[model samples]
Target chain A: MALPGFLRRERIVARPGFNRWLIPPAALAVHLCIGQAYATSVYKAALVEDFGTSQTAIGIVFSIAIVMLGLSAALFGTWVDRNGPRAAMFTSACFWVSGFLVGGLGIETGQLWLLYLGYGVLGGIGLGIGYISPVSTLIKWFPDRPGLATGMAIMGFGGGALIASPLSRQLMSYYDPAYDGTAGTVPNGDAVAALFFTLGAVYLVFMMFGAFIVRVPAEGWRPDGFDPSTVKQKALVTTESVSAKNAVKTPQFWLLWTVLFCNVTAGIGILEQASPMIQDFFRTGDSSTVAATAAAGFVGVLSLFNMAGRFAWSTTSDFIGRKPIYMVYLGGGLVLYVLLATVGSSATWLFVLLAAVIISFYGGGFATIPAYLRDLFGTYQVGAIHGRLLTAWSAAGVAGPLIVNSVLDTQGEPGSLVAANYRPALFIMVGLLAVGFVANLLVRPVASKWHEPHSDAATTPTPARSAAR
Target chain B: MSTSVSKDPTPNGQQPVHTPAALIAFAWTLVGVPLAYGLYQTIKTASTLFTG
Candidate 1:
């Protein structure tokens, strides 16, 4: 469990006058690289064609990676906290880069399991670890603005797909002379494999940049002009720390979990079906009005909203408080889903507006959760608790699509279905959001029974000596 | 069981230390350019939703 000398948590503590501003970019470096997880759809058809397999088989590669992201984060959360961001980032880069290399090898040799093992398992571990690596450190560095700090980093995950999607397509086209990066032109497996190698090499430099530059704030470090007591005056902003082990035992944790699950589930319903859903909603008959290119554009617009909301809403949470923000995401989202189900087909613009805001809330929920946890639980062991809570995302990832897909299946076949067919699923999301609204309402500060003794008193240890332990 | 916020004075009094302006700008630019490019490309693609 001992990290090398340089990777040790003690080694990276900031000295006095160290610029806290430098930290966010470091966090973003890793996040933007791993955020490529969302870009898998770009090459999905190519993988399917080359592997001579069902879409579901290739889709499982992403599924396994997501599941592993949650599982590894939960398992490694404590170790990451016990070590530090630098070690966690280093470890994550290794697993992530290795996953690509191994996955590329699988593609060259025609082995699907190797793709699963490489990207799904190894890369997933990297995702989980990388996701939480900078969280607690960021919070400590920017206690006055936890929401803004975390948002800047987590937003990269949403934006990652934006970069990766276009990058992947261009890379594939370059690697394969026959593929023109146009519709129905699938790249060969060799090109896709080469694309993976290129991405792995590029991501290595960025992620390592993050690992080297990231620093934990020194002991007694607080931003100039910040008042901790001012933060404490807010409702549900706790100053006491809770160990991650006891965090699950608290009712607040489960409530936030449900809130997150419902928010994510509802958002994914639109996201999973964005392209087809828009076209289907606007369908006039067998032929629909919306063109395929426009539908692709709709998806792109949603991605923009998704990325923007992560930063906008989470930064807003800094002023408005975390609890009220969830009220907006869950409670407000309930109303939007209702509108999306009822009058969405009335016009294309209205439908896009509704879906864009809904997706933004989805992204906002993700960016805000860690700050929310910092509110209910103290900073101590927060990264681990955040890791544990991500299991909800893993659960929602499956549930969201299943709910929409199953409802759509019963309604009729894909591509031919009308807006009426989607009404049932949208209403179902409405109900889920209603449940999350209530869960958000019930969240209270962690009870005294769960607080670690002498929580704030433990902060006295000098960063190097304390973290080195 | 009650936890209160720590009101410790800043470790360094009177003056605050910051990373050099040039270094800060360099670091921000490192991550900002790619992010800006991605945003630009995505917006360009999204524009087709209205036009097409």
Candidate 2:
């Protein structure tokens, strides 16, 4: 029987003014704010001065925030799917703002625990929820353009830190002026507190924009001209929807997890220590020279590349397929890491170029994976699955910084960061990427058992289903 | 792919039909107001943190 006309109108109109172009920008607004997590390094100096804390201790704040982001995403992914993106984003805004306010209070009171609770726990919730809200919806809206759609959102995430780093530095400088006579001294903690509050407020507004604009396409709707068969032209792993519980049981999930972990770890290792690494590599005994500023600018330049690559490479995945693009990320990344280990200090530009490329892949990996999940698991439960997969990111966040920092810290002297200093870390990244490369190759098409065909008729096997027999 | 494979045939189809403007407005309020309020609180707190 044909469905009623009123029902059809209701269904068609539910799709609203939604188009592919709108989805990416909506995703970008939220992603850009969450991406500020990348800029935490820029604030390290300020934190150390204000709190009289060690670098390792401050690093824990980032670590906690990242872990919580994964955990919260896993916990809330189902709620997002049920209640929709608006609810999730609103919740995110609340937690994120409270985190900033609470963190500011902590800073003023010189209480490190509050800082952890505020920024790490509360803010992390915001990151996780905000991060996943737009992904599945955008994919559904642009089934034909999953890679491009998700990439646009994820690109904002990667580039967010590019804007944040400069903004944060400026805010820090404005609030905490350097004392002329005192080395490494910061002004009152009040300024820093004020800055955090301002950031929180601004982030809330941007995130709200994302929440307001985002809407899910009505069920079963494809773009007017798209053909689903074209999705197979790119990758072999595409499958119908699988529940999140089932997705976790599959080997593909684990393999993709490893891929994301290796990519993130390798990129973050370079990014976290970029400024200091450059200073140590090319120090010419002039502490106040233009070289120092130039090196910082170089780090900023890498940020731009990292940001652009998220959009560019991930969008390319639509054409070339996920597994092949990852081959480039792992294989090309390994070569770059090797070059850095063997001949990095020989020329500064080589190190910069290689680092920029690796970081881009790292950011690209994040931006691309939501679409990849949509391909592998189907859109039915992808948001939850994506949320669950983020546990890999939390793990990488810890592993990357640990490998880089522990190796460097163990070397003791600041000047000891010569080519030899990073040899072990670089090799470790290479080995990790190789492992990921193999894992990517092992991925196969999802099996029939995982597909969630609606209604019991799927199981009944009518003559239409049994015709081949 | 064989015709037996068939495209997804779930009710409402694969694409979402148009959402009522009222629903969009309602959804926007659900997300937007809290966020704006949060921002206001953040700004207020920041000013206090800096000035005080």
TM-score of each: 0.95, 0.82
DockQ (CA atoms), all models: 0.30, 0.06
Error of 2 at A229 (Å): 2.6
| Superposed model 2: Cα runs more than 4 Å off | A1-13, A176-187, A237-239, A283-290, A456-469, B1-52
Q: For model 1, how does the per-residue alpha-carbon lDDT over A1-469 read when each residue is reduced to its tens digit? A: 5679999988887756577788899999999999999999988998898899999999999989999999999999999999999999999999999999999999999999999999999999999999999998998888888999899999999988999999898899999989997787999999999999999999999999999999997766666666678987999999888999999999999999999999999999999999999999988778879988899999999999999999999999999999999999998999988998899899999999999999999999999999999998989899999999999999998999999999999998888899999999999999999999999999988899898888455756433111110
Candidate 2, after superposition: displacement of residue A453 in Å? 3.1
Candidate 2 CAPRI category:
incorrect
lDDT of 2 by residue, A138-222 (tens): 7877788788888877776765666665566567667766622122555456777777888999988877776666656554445
- Model 1 off-target regions past 4 Å? A455-469, B1-18
lDDT of 1: 0.89
